[model samples]
Target: MLIKFDVTNEEGDRLKMQYGQKVASKAFKMAALDAFDLYHKNQELHEVIDSQRTEIRRLRNIIEQARSSAAQLLEKTGQGDLIDG
Candidate 1:
């Protein structure tokens, strides 16, 4: 997700006063780079999660098919009541 987060003026002033201009600018640069890296990582994690969900749905479908086939087989073999009981 593309987030719209901002560092306010008060925060900027605090950083400047506490760390001086050079260090403060470097810190801001690092923060921006870190945020960029995190955004890409977050996107990758989401993609993985989506793929896993798709896989789970596929597996569920297979399981349902197997159960249906098993019931059919039992019915053909005169064992339908065996499963119901």
Candidate 2:
């Protein structure tokens, strides 16, 4: 496939530099494919990181809830000040 790009030069022949994408060789195609592969891999990694972040937040919330419940239990049993002292 042809991948044309813009080429602008003042005081130069317009015909010499076409102001659009043009045909690319096998090397260009390979490079483009490699770039695409990297992009997809990066996207996948980002998704995994985001998922891990969500889990971490959830776990943190659970830990906070457990701590709060434990404190309340201790207060009801008149043992809250034992730890504080």
Candidate 3:
């Protein structure tokens, strides 16, 4: 399908208006492309954050295990009082 429209300045010059609209349209397209690129990069960053969260949880579990083992050792050595809990 094809559609067309005519616009004119106060001096009745259509060429000037057409040129201005063309320039404006180009700028709008460029801006839209930049926005899309930024959205894509944001999504990538979110994935990285999710992976880092998983890694932090795993490290926390390891630390808890070490603490439990140390407390058990103190009890066997008759120094359980050294452990707070």
- In model 2, state the lDDT of residue 41: 97
lDDT of 2 by residue, 2-82 (tens): 665544443123433332324334334555567889899999999999999999999999999999999999999999888
**Global Cα lDDT for candidate 2:** 0.70
TM-score, per-candidate, Cα-based: 0.63, 0.60, 0.60
lDDT of 1 by residue, 1-85 (tens): 3444377877766766654555556556556767888899999999999999999999999999999999999999999999979
Better of 1 and 3 by lDDT: 1
> Would you list the clashing residue pairs of candidate 1?
none
**Model 3's lDDT to the true fold?**
0.69
Model 2 alpha-carbon drift over 4 Å, by segment: 1-31
Report the C-alpha lDDT of model 3 over 1-85, residue by residue, as the tens digit.
3323443334223333634544544434445567889899999999999999999999999999999998889989999877655
How displaced is residue 1 in candidate 1, in Å?
Answer: 27
Q: Rank candidates, lDDT, best first.
A: 1, 2, 3
Regions of model 1 farther than 4 Å from truth: 1-30
Quantify all predictions' global Cα lDDT against the true fold.
0.80, 0.70, 0.69
Which candidate leads the pack in TM-score? 1
